[model samples]
Target: MSMDAPTFRVGVVVERRPSKSPWVDHAWRIVAIIPEAIGTEPGHVLGHDGEAVLLYAGARSVEFHRVETGNYRDNLTSGSPGLWVTLALTDEEPGIRLISVTADPAEGESLTEIGDLMVEIAPMPPEIAERLAAFVETHHVERVFTKRKRQ
Candidate 1:
C-alpha cells in the first residue's frame, strides 16, 4: 500500500519453541490471511509457548504498513528491505498481544530497544507479499521531483 496507507490482515499468532538450537529462544510467527472485510479479528491463537509472557488476553491480529519510498531507498542503500515485526506487551491482560508489522527498520529497531521487547525481521509469505504490493500500487503516489530555488 501507499506509505500512508496501512494494510491489515487477520491471522492467528503461532508460537514456535527453540528445538534445534540453544541460541534460539522462542518466536511468534505471523500466519496471516487476507480477510474478506476490514477490521476482522482472527478466530483464535495457534500453537503455544509456555516461556512467552502474554501481554494481552485472547487472539491478536497484525497491522502491516507499506514502506515509504524514502525508507525504501534508504533500505536499498543499506542492503536491507526494512521489513520488521514488533511484539508489544499490553497492560490489559496477560495472555496475548497485538503484533505490528512494518517496512521501516528504524521504527522497529527503536521499539525493541526502547521498549525492551522482541522484534523480528522475518520473510513475508508470498501471498502477503503480493497483497502488500497490490496495496502499494493502489495507494502509493509517485514523488515528483521539484527543483529548489536558490535564495
Candidate 2:
C-alpha cells in the first residue's frame, strides 16, 4: 500500500484463546483512519511509535481494540500492563477475508502479499491506538537497510 494517510477503516486482528476454551480465537478490532505499511522485513516491528493494540475477549468493547505484526516474545517485553501483539491491518471487508489471521486462508489468498512479513496482529487500548495512528501517518520507511544483495 502507499504511504499516504489511509482513508478507510483499518481492521486489527489478534490470536487468542478464551479463558475457558481450548481453541484459539483471533478476536480483536481497531477500526481507525491511519496509514499502514506492507514490506519485506525479518520478523516484524508492529508499531511506529510505542502505540499498538491489545486484542483480548472482554477487557474492552470492540471499538477500542487494535492489532499489529509481532511474536510471543514481543508480548512479554512490551512493557504495557497487559502487552499484546498487533499483527496486521486491512480495509473493512466481510466474512473474515484473507486479512483475518483466524480465517487461515491459503497462500495466494484474496489478501495482497505482504512480502516476508507474517501476519502478526494484536489488540490495544484507545490511547495507544491514537499514538499508532499518528506515527504511521507521518513515518517514512527506509528500504536501503532492508535490501538483500545478489551474489
Candidate 3:
C-alpha cells in the first residue's frame, strides 16, 4: 500500500488538432517526456521507451496516450474525460523513465477540458485514473494531475 511505488513507463506529448471531435481523438504523438538525464524537463523527451504510442490531437496541444498498458482501454472508456499527467522514476533506475499522461483533455479547448488533475498512486473509482497510476508505478514516472473545467 505504499504510495511511491513504480509501475509503468509513462510519457506526454503535445499535438495540435484543427478540429474538435465529440470524443477525445487519438491522433498525435509524444512531443516529450521526462527525459532520463538530469536538467532535462519532466515529460519533455520523446521516444524514451521502445513502445508504441497513440496521441490525441487537440486545438492547441497533443495528448500522448499509450496503448500497450492493459489498463488503457478501461480508463479511456470511462465517462470522465479529464485526467492527470505525471512522471514516474525510481531511486535506482536511470535512463529509464515512466511518464504518466492521463486519457483526459486540457483547458482552452472549450468542449474538451473536464476536471482537475488528481495525482496519487491509489485505486480510484474511475478505471482510467487507476490505469494511469498503474502505468506511472510500472514506469516510475512522477505525475502531476491538471484539472479541467466545463465551458
Candidate 4:
C-alpha cells in the first residue's frame, strides 16, 4: 500500500425480494477496504521551457467493484436488489483509475454526466478477494437459524 494512496471500502448493493416478506430496499454493505495506487509516471515526455510536457495518450477511466461471496449468495436467493457497484473518479486526481466503492448505484451514474463513463460492476474476482479474505472472515458474522414459536 502506498503511503499517499487512499483506501476505500468496497461494497455491493443488492436489491432483493422475499416470498415471505415485502421487497427489501437496496442495501449497500462494505466488503473490503483496500489501498489503491493511482499515480504512474508518464511514459513519454518532452522538455519545453524548462518544464516537462507529458505526451498525450488516449486512455479511458475505469472502475472496479468487488462483491463478497456471502452478499452475492443472498442477492441471488432473494432475487431483488440487482447486483451493482458504485464507481467514481478519485478525488486525488482526474484521468486516473482510482474508484471509490459506494453502495448507491445512482452515485456512479451521477459521476458520468454524458454517460460515457466506463464503470464495470461485476462479481468480485476470487483472486482479489483472496487477499482480504482473512479480514472479512474474521469480521463477518454468520446468521444462525432458529425456529420461531407459534402464536
The TM-scores of all predictions, comma-separated, are 0.47, 0.19, 0.20, 0.28
Off-target runs (Cα >4 Å) in candidate 3 are 1-6, 17-39, 42-151
Report the Cα lDDT for candidate 3. Answer: 0.35
Candidate 1 residues lying further than 4 Å off, grouped into runs, are 1-6, 16-67, 72-83, 89-96, 134-151
Which window of ten consecutive residues has the lowest lDDT sum in model 3? 54-63
Pick by lDDT: 3 or 4, better one? 3
- Report the CA-based lDDT of candidate 2 relative to the real structure: 0.31
Per-residue lDDT tens digits for candidate 1, residues 42-73, read 33333345753321212323344444645444
Better of 1 and 2 by lDDT: 1
lDDT tens readout by residue for model 2, 34-101? 22223312123233322333332112111211222122223323553122222332333221222232
Clashing pairs in 1: 1-135, 1-136, 56-96
Residue-wise C-alpha lDDT for candidate 4, range 1-151, written one tens digit per residue: 3322213433222221223435422222223222332342322222222222222111222222233334533433443323233333232322223233432345444655645343444444344344334434444456679999999
Give the candidate order by descending TM-score.
1, 4, 3, 2
List of clashing residue pairs for candidate 4 = 14-81, 15-80, 15-81, 16-80, 16-81
Model 3 — TM-score against the truth?
0.20
The candidate that achieves the highest TM-score relative to the unseen native structure: 1
Best by lDDT: 1
Candidate 4 stretches greater than 4 Å from native: 1-69, 72-84, 87-120, 123-127
Model 2 residue 65 CA deviation (Å) reads 21
Judge candidate 1 against the unseen true structure and give its global Cα lDDT, from 0 to 1: 0.48
